[model samples]
Target: MRYIRSIYIFCSIVTSVRSGASELPEERELTTNFSSMSLTKVPEGLTPITTTLDLSYNLLFQLQHSDFRSLSKLKVLILCHNRIQELDIKTFEFNKELSYLDVSNNRLKSVTWFSLAGLRHLDLSFNDFDTLPISVETGNMSHLETLGLSGAKIQKSDFQKIAHLQLNTVLLGLRTLSHYEEGSLPILNTTRLHIVLPVNTNFWVLLHDGIKTSKILEVINIDQKSQFTSYESQQIPILENAKTSILLLNKVDLSWDDLFLIFQLVWHTSVEYFQIQHVTFGGKVYLDHNSFDYSNTVMRTIKLEHVHFRIFNIPQESIYLLFTKMDIENLTISDAQMPHMLFPMYPTRFQYLNFANNILTDDVFKKSIQLPHLKTLILKDNKLETLSLVSHFASNTSLRHLDLSENLLQHENDENCLWPETLVTMNLSFNKFADSVFGCLPRNIQILDLNSNKIQTVPKAITHLTSLRELNLAFNFLTDLPGCSHFRRLLVLNVEMNLILSSSLDFFQSCQEVKTLNAGRNPFRCTCELRDFIQLGKYSEGMMVGWSDSYICEYPLNLKGTQLKDVHLPEISCN
Candidate 1:
């Protein structure tokens, strides 16, 4: 069905380019309004155009083969920010002089020979290419030098085809590269390749293959698991003198075995930067240890950003000593179970230490992690069950953005926990809180994620959240909401999967500042009152509530998977 539309759109663009209606010599169209415009017209005697055409942000639906029939002099074509779906060399027959082509930000499914034949640089990013290409012959792109196939789905087979392409260089996105199968990377011909993979043994195989193929190449920029590869292999003789940086993306995939493997790999090399991320793994990942030189490890920088470890009873002082000689900056040890002594006893070189996730029970805060140069203390997500630890960092005066989400905190009276004061972004979601808990947070909080908790209603006392810009309360037990017109600065309100009924539509309408609303998966009754809710959801900037098609009718009008925004209210005459 869509194939016909794309073909029609392509015919229109080609006719316009050949007719020379603002189409340049270099195929670059910018901010042109071509929305809902028909491409069926084949302008008369239109010819003689060349080099660089920009057809972006034109609300174009599709690109067909007949569009480029008259663009014989075209070189570079920029079709980003359009609605192009498919591409083929048949579309480029008019542009016989084509070189570079950018078809990113479209809805392409795959890359094939028919689409690319005559170019050097091609940008096919931000499309849907889930698997590697089926065609692998290589003559499709003969003169191509630099290709940007980043963010596309290129499988092992496609990679093998690319390797066979014998191109010298390319830039790819890591997010796209991580989706590769466990053990199927294509064979390579380049001397060096920027490979991104999880910290698994297969990555080792890829590195081994690259080493065997490209020995004279420079620079091996690796992610978290790359740290382990640097230490475990004798291949360092091949890449030793080359400048290397192993970025440890925190918490994505770090097992105990992988951690020690990475440490051992980095122990002897001049590798720089060990970064941690925000994803959490099991506590068992940090249990293993490999031997390293306690005295001579000379790597310069060590950053533990967003690392979650569970070392309750182990002697962590040695881990601290490992980084004594290095200059550490953003040290974030978040969402972990750590002992009290993980902090440095004396003023050290680190500038920030974010121990945001821990079991901060009594006696945990008696002393501080004395990082005199420490400027920000993010203790968010810690089960601060009690408020005793709050006073520990109060003296620091530099702490900002304290998040205490998902904590089983209770007040001094041992009943319910309240929000903290003077923080930038306080995340009190998924916690047991009293009605007065909102009073504890100062008016300085800018962001709050109060989702997934036992709160049954929105308090009218929310005037204090005037500084708040984002609030998330999805998956709660709330059935009703109080007036929220006071939150002038609020931009996002996520209340998906709640017990919101038709009566809550008025409450949502009052908050005019809201730009995004998530009301999907809620028990919303399709009553006449719900009609207004549906209407507001359709018209409001909030996502789910803005559309009748987006709003899933949970009750009397049970639309299991309908988009409420796209639904028509007249068709659903709720009784």
Candidate 2:
């Protein structure tokens, strides 16, 4: 019953509009939004014009000839997001101007490309054309720039398809077969290709081809979406594939032993960027001190985000010993809901370090890691209690950015003065500061985020940041900012989601240089005291209060929920 009514309502609206509007012009594109309409064919007498035709999100099962009798000049045809299974070659012959066609997200078994002589871009992905063969002389798709066949079962029989098409970017599904003739990969002569493999893929045999013709391959993205897992391989291949830069192992579930093997392989691969996050451990991995032969170890950038970094039975001493073996320039290791783990004391050449989403406390950094080249250190969502341990970096002059947000840090002593003198940005959000201030920070600190804290009053310590560029004090309990009078160089300030009234916007008077100001999402009093501030935020271009025109009034029962920007408040007379 509901289905019939929906179709009736849709037809009613479309027919009503179609009867009054002019015919779909020959030069204009047509978009028929029949989403969830259970449509099987194009509607009768709806001859939309050429250049483009979109029939996305429909229940189309097949495409026939008469469906496009009117679109002779159609260049781009999108039949995606439909249930199309069979497409007739005669169906597309009606339109000779076709250049780009998308038939993805369907159930196509085989498609004929002979009619599309001028196609430049073709997407046939997410289909079930498992064993498709290609033609030699008849079909000329030599002008195609991009051809995507992701999630299609591409076998050796389908290798003929690549032999003909002239594509710059060819995206294919994973292949695990062990054999490939020397001339088999001539099809990838001058194209960039990306192949997905499982985390446990035995890369030795699979890499022989890529290493032989390194320039032919581009990226080797290892993901967890595949069903195959190979654990017996030990050697990791490093190809002269100059285009292969990133080795991302996202959500790789491996045993502790496999993890070590993967790390060793990556270390030997010399790939510039390597990241392994959301790793699941299968068992314990024991490593002797002799495991790391750091004789010719190059300092590589590595990030390990085992948010569940401890599914194995291992001691912190072993972890630190193994991790510090490399000359790490940038390192990130984090875990959730674990006991406090110590930072590696050895990575002295570090530059960017992200230790966020862990169980690290302030005392963990009591002994500095001697990284004079370190620039950024992220410690957000941790268990830091105080800034007392910041003194450990007293000798460091290169450390710049430090993040301590979402921690247990409290304002006790002026220990923030001990932060590195070269520091630029700091995040101290979501702590237990109410009315207390922080005047002990370094003068060079520019960007500060004190958002989501219980700050009822603006900490007078903020004015000490004379070189501050941006400040975010959002989602607090501040009725007003009496301490913002000193922000001269501040460019951005977001104080949204607070208990702020409109009359207290006098802080903007001091922020003459502030470019972006977000004071929305607060309960406004709707009295005449808010006219200047509301008007300035809604009308003025310099101080962009985000969504200032859409905010609503919360007080005065008569005007409750009224859009604050729409309301015109009278100016109050001082007399």
> What's the CA RMSD for each of the models?
14.1, 8.2
Query: For each candidate, how many residue pairs have backbone atoms clashing (under 3 Å)?
Result: 47, 1
| lDDT by residue (tens digit), candidate 2, 286-321 | 444347555443436667776455456766556655
> What TM-score does model 1 achieve against the real structure?
0.46
- Writing each residue's lDDT as its tens digit, candidate 1 over 1-575 gives 00101100222353255434354423343222232343323223434453555565455556656666666766766665566556565567667668777665566665545644677866665555655433543436777765545443445665665665666544332324445442343354543344433223235444433334432222223334444433544233323432334433322544444554545555555444444445433334333332434344444444454445543443465554445424455555544565443444665655555566665554455666555454445566665665434534543444455556666754343323333354576566767754445545546678877776666776665445678888787877778543466566777777777788655644657776777776667766665666666676655554544344446666565554555444456734654
Compare the candidates by TM-score and give the number of the best one: 2
Q: Report how far residue 446 has shifted in candidate 1, in Å.
A: 1.7
Span of 10 residues, lowest total lDDT, candidate 1: 1-10
CA shift of 420, model 1, Å: 9.7
Per-prediction TM-score to the true structure, in the order listed: 0.46, 0.73
The alpha-carbon lDDT assigned to residue 180 of candidate 1 equals 47
